[model samples]
Target: PARFEEGDTLVSWLAEIVGFSPSDTRLAREVPFMQDTSTGRPAGKIDLVVARVADTGLQWYGLEIQAVYFSGRGMQSEYEALQNDVDPYPPFPGAVRRPDWRSSSAKRLMPQLQIKVPTLRRWGSKLAVAVDGPFFESMGGPSSNPSRDLNDGDIIWMVPVLLPKERGGFLLSRGHWEVLTLEESSRKLLAAETVSRNAFEQTLLEKLKPLVRPTE
Candidate 1:
């Protein structure tokens, strides 16, 4: 997995899922929340914000995209610590290491559900997460119980598949987009368990192998 250099790639992919035309979508990058007096800056900037029409009506959503690959000091240092066999949990006082892709994705997502999603809902918008299929699969493969509550509102998950490209490259396209309410996602998350890096790697390889050219 590689880091998406351009945010538009993700935005376009999401737009395809939501059926947002060029005129309907607006890219609000680095949207400021509120100013932090201590830091003298905005609290934080959202990665992306998309405004479009839902079945109910026109709505805005905070779109968060998470990738397996990362770069630079923060992730690099964490990776190094993990390689050194540092315990992720405290009480043993081991160094903080990077988490597995599934855990990392969860770490990034939980807060959005707990904080950002609710806040955005209050502001008359919603939160939608676009994650790779592997990560989604790691999150317990969606909830099966149909009687679950939908009180907290719907949480849309746009999962794109990796398609075999005719050329040497691979394309992430043509996959399932699921809409899970907050309760449903929470249930799925609760049932989810951490999978090993090797397992995930193997699964991804199998899925992407069709795109690879046969060696002569």
Candidate 2:
């Protein structure tokens, strides 16, 4: 439905949402997510890079936004597949997956930055992903099922509705529901549009600030 640039926009917005400055951070722009030469797997890219500096230490952040639809397929699983550069054999396997942008980029950047800094490691890296989708039903809801176990990291499977107060505030989630009625979810999205946009911008600034280099 969209392109990679949309993912970049979302990452930029997310950094701003968490109180990062645009000027202070380093934006890698469109760093390529390279595929495995041998396996021909789908490698996802990192849309944004954030460098955070404190008196005690410095932190590098990687951000990615998943706007595509992966309802039946699990978000984490997709993440993992990209990180590993290996597609699932059966296809649509539900699991948590990480992105390979950090690992591959770090390896490539190490030699370049090592001459100046002399120290670089791939671990302890922080990654954040903003998923764009409707909510999924969790535990303790009306007609809830025991099999539907969703964690915080998991995305909501249902769409949101921003309806008038008379109608209802929002249609949160509907798990395993065959049909989706957008009327309610549309209203919810309308109400949340401003807040979502603002949050995204804030997150972008927050994550981008650290990557910005000092002026000469």
Which candidate has the highest lDDT of all? 1
lDDT of 1 at 62: 71
lDDT of 1: 0.63
Q: Pick the candidate with the highest TM-score.
A: 1
Checking candidate 1 for backbone clashes, the offending pairs are none
Global lDDT scores for all candidate models: 0.63, 0.39
What TM-score, computed on C-alpha atoms, does each candidate reach? 0.60, 0.29
lDDT score for residue 140 of model 2: 16
State the lDDT of candidate 1 residue by residue for 31-132, as single tens digits: 886578998788866777777765777756677776664322355555565677755442332345443654555565665576666666677665667777
TM-score of 1: 0.60
Consecutive 10-residue window with the lowest summed lDDT within model 1:
143-152
**lDDT at residue 162 of model 1 (Cα atoms):** 66
For 22-110, candidate 2 gives per-residue lDDT tens digits of 66555664454456688877464555566657565765555544333322435665566667665434355455454333232223322
